[model samples]
Target chain A: MPSPLRDLREQIIRAASVAGEGHIASAFSILDILWVLYHGILRHDPGNPSDPARDRFVLSKGHASLGIYGILAQRGFFPMDELKTFASSSGRLGGHPDSRKVPGVEASTGSLGHGMPMAAGMALGLKIRESASRVVCIVGDGECNEGAVWEAALLAAHHKLGNFTCVVDFNHSGDRALMLGDLAGKFRSFGWEVTEIDGHDHAQIEAVLKPHGGDVPRAVIANTIKGRGCTDMENNPAWHHKAPKADELEAVLAQLT
Target chain B: MRRQFVTTMERQLDEDPRTVILLGDIGVFAFRNAFKKHPKRIINIGILEQATVSVAAGLAKEGFIPLFHSIAPFVVERAFEQIKVDFGYQALGGHFVTVGGSYDYAALGCSHHCPGDVGLMQAVPGMQIIVPGHPAEFDALMTQTFASGKPAYHRLSERSNREARCVTFGKAEVVQSGGGPVIVTVGPFLDRVIEAAGGSDATILYYTTLAPFDAETLRQHAGDGRILCVEPFYEGTLAASITSALRGKRIALSSMGVPRKFLTDYGHASYHDAACGLMATDIRARLDELSHV
Candidate 1:
């Protein structure tokens, strides 16, 4: 694992430990995808977060807010020290990303199936203004169960939002409740250019994150393990919402290294 | 009224570059000319009410003033959480202009009816609810409030009052003043309320804007502490505002509108209105009963 990615995992673990609450497994699933987007793909500035021409990224699956917050902190949108206040009343960072409070967050999304449509709208707005900016929204496989997710898929396709991309974190977290079978095929049928990739692979993530020149929107199915780094937590539903205690934190950090 | 909405939107589109119209496949024909003029601005977004609202929120986030149009139930009731969360929680400004207010689509069954839209929107903090009684009033209210940088719900109805009063946002017009009980009416109910309170000493307050509830006007005109709200939506939609407006004072409040229950009996809006006792005679009797009290 890359040193920075390893450090980010440690930061997420410690912050969730301090807060005593977070969807740690969910965060781990999308950490690398978020890291690649913020570091390489998204045209954003921590200094001027509200740049009119900046590409918008909406984490539609907001339970993984810890992942985005850690990346944003590392990216200098805010100081890394703020991570200690994660999910605390005094902190701007909550369990779910709030756009109003957070600098880099484009949409305040906690509810599943909202971010993609919002991203489509942003893409549509940019297209109307003849701007070069793009919008990327990430949704969980569980979020696909929401009718609004498919509704947004149909809308983005109908509008021919070529600038919009929806990344699905296919961590199989939703498989226990209702299996989202054939997600890529579903996006293809909905008129989106579908790309399936290993979410943890930074090279694979960076390759598909760019603007694909076409009228149809794009959907990236990012196949990821629930907890990619830690051995005990990997693909474990029990770790979905659990934060490590002091002893468990030592073991999780060891696994990350 | 939908025609007036189209006309107003056309004028808005021509005047303002930021104005975007998102239709939910309902009023596509009406916006044909507008679509021709501003092809990109006027989008006939498919019948996905939830996604459409979030899309409008997205547009708002991008600093464009988006106006989403659809039926009352689909836009306001069905996609209410989108309006509440996407716009209200985000503090993003957009407009939701809905036709088929209350039982306006009464014959289409309960699925199409949204008598609870105003009430539902009222629950969303900072949401501006406008129930225009006339086409001209719709134009005036939409013109004034659409770009106010706040989430607003504009409920348009097929029924219009005989006359159009000069309406302002958040300010209720005193149609007639009396020393008797205050009779509050909103949207098209103004004419019916007026007719009901005919030859009586009841003060009629017409509300084109429901939210930011014109409590000042209500407080000033609410003499003898007897208030009767005759709304076009669910009964007591404005109860909180009324009571909150005159909190300390002892006020006798009664309301008449579409019952909170579903109307399983399919019929025209007029038939539903009559069934729900929303006619002038019923309103007059209610007024008389309040007067006696």
Candidate 2:
């Protein structure tokens, strides 16, 4: 079997190849968080899709959908073979995750600034049901431009949803590398207990998540490298979604080796 | 009406823990005392309309019935994505109570006027649009909406009006039956149409159920003559429904309320008949013209 990290990288490539468009940098940046959540931390069952107690995860940064799609394919939510349908007209996958179309997808998301409140809602539901399950979300640092995100951030704390955790994939870059500014501190202003971390370190993510309970809603600002783990494409905007022509693909593949 | 809505919900919550009530800063209205009564169940979700409906959808997937309420335009227009994706895509049972069926905020002008809610909301699948005519219909619709157990948008008036006699959820309410002209009224504006027609002089068809309409009632009431419809807002409301169901079987179904084009007009009339289009005078004049044929 391919290593989980390696499998994720290939899935990202495959998903982009199928759709022919993607936020490649953001997708790669959140790869480790997606890996650690699905493989090591979150409790879920691939076999039974509707288990009430399963920990829920919302890819709130839905532009980076390939990460979640890649993990779902690996977990056998559908089949690994179905990745071929990603973002095609006849496909179950779209540019973002649509829960109605895909099994094991907790909620439909593509509209950024909208998913976290739904995540908070899911967390609220778990609490109302008196279940021990938690709700987790992966959001993008740049997507904080939306006013709705702050509303949700304030709501998450106001509700006292300690069972909910948000991980912000902070690539320190934007469509133009300028935004509303100071995203990690912005989370603090919204009353989130914030932590900044190295997103590429799987061990750091694993070590930080060992504790289950907390009093406040937590935010992990995972400082990541856009186009991470790639050699020449590491910070190149051209590779954001451009299909690496044969030579570049080979070069990218060689770095993984 | 808010009391009726929340009390009915309270009854449902007592039976099933999954029933939830979400208000978008709509506490000044009544019956949602349930929020204070049961803190876990009733949530004043503040003014964020977009997040409110998305969160409702999330709560619904967890097997809860979410009753969402707010001003007409903000609740429906602001959170359209949430409504379309969360509720419409999934067809979850959500009771969306949107106040201000028409120009209730006469002075608030364009932003507050929800001329497009019913028509827009009606286009969504499994979404039942309700324009209850009076307090009685409001109470009945509240009970029936829960019993129907489906996604619905109920547009209620901010002020109470002359109470209509009867209200059936999916069944059409036949107000004043007569042979010449049939006035199909939506929301509390039905009272104006009934009054304008000089009591039992003309037939009035009050629509408490905007969609999944009692086509049989429309077919029976709307035969071989002009049927006048009075509503608070635009052509999108019940006009499309009547058009779709009846289909080219023209009985001269002219809508009474709201301008067909962009209404740059302002001010809330105690009733919107002639000013907004659904006045009995307009209906009477139209019937006169249609009777010529």
Candidate 3:
């Protein structure tokens, strides 16, 4: 069932491995979600990142920089070769996503708890302007501790914004520790239709990609590992930040390939 | 001050469709008419001050100039992170108009009335702080801030300050003229310094912009005399930023504002102003004491 897109998870990890750079594990966790959005879901023209009709994908949990950058490259939004500059200076890739620098990025978000509200605002802006472009806000389960997340969730649901969909990368670890891991119930409490699924399973992710039962904004809680792909990095919080040694890179790429 | 900001916001909404004004369940009176003129442009996000700020940040992210109006203590204090993360990190077009700067709601109790609203938010990257001295300065500052495509905090005092010479952005008003002593004042509370220093040998100036105030401008007006500062809001940053600019000069500096702790004991208007030494006589005594030291 795994295809060329499935293989991209290995390629992205390989790029970061080559440079010994990036939050590799965090990126590895949300690969399927990004893959589905870029390849199948998003209505975009790669030539125009600012194309008004294009749907937006906000990396609210922006620390997972590797996942988004890899998707952009694989989708031809940028040169696949450019991904070698993952976390290096002079590279467009920041430790967090920078919308101003990154072509396909909608907004810059590295600080926790900010991404969703802006996404909700964009969704509302599109509604007021009568644009049909949908907005996908990728949030971290742990990052949900921010009270603004709930506030935005309420706004989205109350407005019955079906054009907006939020996917929580329920990787069980924020920068420090596990955030509220119960995604479905939390979203339920905040009045969102919740869907729980395996994050890495492409079929599982695609099945739930449809709009919610009603006009309420939906939150898909994708259960994922922190560092998912490489054997050495899986579930390892030590790999939360980048410091992959050269030999370590060779080893990771070998296993991934 | 609140009415002027609201009126100007309504004017901008008519002038530019890109402008959106959000009130945090506090300033409904100001935007009631705007709802009729531009219903889509105005939002009343009830009671949730933090959400109100982030919602504005969202609107700003999409190239809309959003004016976030709320009382000083609640707007800045409660929603500090939303301001920092949403607008500060991303560099959005959100203007936080904090009405009621100093002891505006002295009678409303402790949670509402303590100074330091602007200082708490000033150091955040990309956030510019503005404190309007009088009604005239309020309009000028509001127009200039909206024109600039950046994040700003316009700190407006609640009291109907005694009208002085009109002030422009970044220009402090020299209320009382004297060479021996110069007391730099900010916000609408300059009325106190005018009363205290009017008959004395002291010069009083109402400083306009708290953030980008050309320190060189303040330094020029601050030499060969005792430089006493009257900050009706938090003393830490406003007074510190000015005094820091005057370092190594022979100008002796003294600062007065509400102490860090929230003062609990409720009192009459005179008691609140004098106790914090926002009153001109209290300021005079501090200057008199500093001279002895």
Candidate 4:
């Protein structure tokens, strides 16, 4: 039997190939974390995507949208056939995810640094409304370069919103890899419960994301490789925005198998 | 104007449970009673403007109508991209209430002076911009804005001493009528325009809302084809909108507002208004010039 991770990678490759180009490597890096979230942690119903009591998931690092699209479809949020229309002129699946266009998407995020602030706001709102639901935001390590992310980080801690959780996909890619030294330390100083873990490990990812009943927002520093499953694409900066060509795609898929 | 905003927001909080007020650590004590009454809804997210606006966007997404408040520059200029993407692009509705229009805080220098706030918001598509002339107008527009369920920006100046007038949303109030020239006063600029007109024959069109602009009213009152626009923000912010409203009409138009340059001369709002030709006397002279043209 094919592993769900392998199946998700195939789905992403198929969609990205049709779209001509995508952040395949970026999507692959966050695949496991997203899988564990939708399958285990997140209290969301595919039938009722707009369930007020359900937990909210915002993919702040929206460049890795394929991972989310794959998971949502697999979990029956929408038809898997919709993935073929990814990045098409009239398709709902654009390069970045839009909440209004897609089901199971809590916030429309493509611009870096907006998701955490939005998630913080959602958490604050949930707290105000006395709802037990939580808000989880997935941000890229590169995306943390934005000052808005830090501003949101400070706000979440200041409010002591325990319902808010930020998962940083610390793949150490791009110029931000060199600039964002000691990422966990930065989040710790911002007053977050920092837990550095091997991102590809599903058990560890699920462990941190589950509620721990603290008076502070939690930051899970999921240390990951840029392209986790594929050997050729792993740690290759060129795969940040570039899709794998025919031969490379075959090679990557073979590795996944 | 800010007091009326707080009063209106307090009422909104009581009426609607979904209404949440988020502040950027500005006006901490101003909303003391509100904080005391509704502790859960009113949130002071420290001095983070970017997060403040983004959080409002997020709350709006989560079925909560969040009314965010801060100084004009911090709310509009500082976190403008958040407004552009989080609210505008995402199609989320949030009420952005900003104080200190133009040189309201002249003593604090250019940082507090947000002369370009309206222009900045105007640049983003789908943002309903409202500038109330009085407390009553503020109340009416605030009610209408929350009810509208659309993304909006309300620019509040420091002065609210003018008599409260019955103002409608998306409709201009014809204060004084004539045929010489149409003197359009935006928000708090009404008192100054009224003073400038001084029983003149020019038609006075006072508008509290700018985005869903009442073009039909402007056409009805602008019979002489001569119009003078007096605004409290950056010059020519509404020129494009006015031009679009009166398209294909042969008319003489002139605008009076704060110039694009920041005025280093520190004083009251009136001082900056005078220096930038945004005061009543300056408006009167411009109206005279427009009438002749």
The number of clashing residue pairs in each candidate reads: 0, 7, 1, 0
Model 2 spans with C-alpha error above 4 angstroms: A175-178, A242-257, B28-33, B147-149, B159-161, B164-166, B176-181, B198-203, B214-216, B248-251, B260-268, B271-274
Candidate 4 ranges with C-alpha deviation above 4 Å: A174-178, A245-252
Global lDDT of each candidate = 0.91, 0.75, 0.76, 0.86
Cα lDDT tens digits, model 3, A118-231, are 888888777667777788889887778888788888888877777789999988886366446466897898888888899988888877875444567889999998777667
Candidate 1 structure quality by residue, lDDT tens digits, A1-257:
46998899889999999989999889889999999998879999999999997999999999999999999999999999899999999999999999999999999999888888888889989989888999998999999999999998988888889999999999998999998889999999999899999999999999999877778899999999999887888998788898988777787788884
lDDT of 1 at B154: 92
Error of 4 at B108 (Å): 1.4
Once model 1 is optimally superposed onto the true structure by TM-score, how far is the C-alpha of residue A86 displaced, in angstroms?
0.8
CAPRI quality band, candidate 4: medium
Chain A TM-score relative to the true structure, per candidate:
0.97, 0.91, 0.91, 0.96
Clashing pairs in 4: none
Q: Which candidate number has the best lDDT?
A: 1
lDDT of 1 by residue, B43-118 (tens): 8888889999998999998889999988888887788899989999998888998888788888889898888899
- lDDT of each residue in B1-293, candidate 4, tens digit only: 77778888888888898888988788778889989999988988678788788899888877899888889898888899999999998878889898887889998998888888888888888889999878888889888778576889998878863698888888988999987898777887888889999867899988888988889998777785788888888878889888888888987778888888877988777677667877678788888887778
State residue A51's C-alpha deviation in candidate 1, in Å.
0.8
Tens digit per residue, CA lDDT, model 4, A1-257: 99878888888887898788789899999999999998879999999999988999999999999989999999999999899899999899988999888999888888788888999988988887778999999999889898889999888898898999999998888454457888899999999999999999999998899977777999999999888887778898767788766766676678774
Give the TM-score of each candidate. 0.98, 0.90, 0.90, 0.96
- Indicate the worst ten consecutive residues by lDDT in candidate 1 chain B: B98-107
- Sort all candidates by DockQ, best to worst: 1, 4, 2, 3
The DockQ values of the predictions, listed in order, are: 0.90, 0.65, 0.59, 0.80
Docking quality level of the chain pair in candidate 2: medium
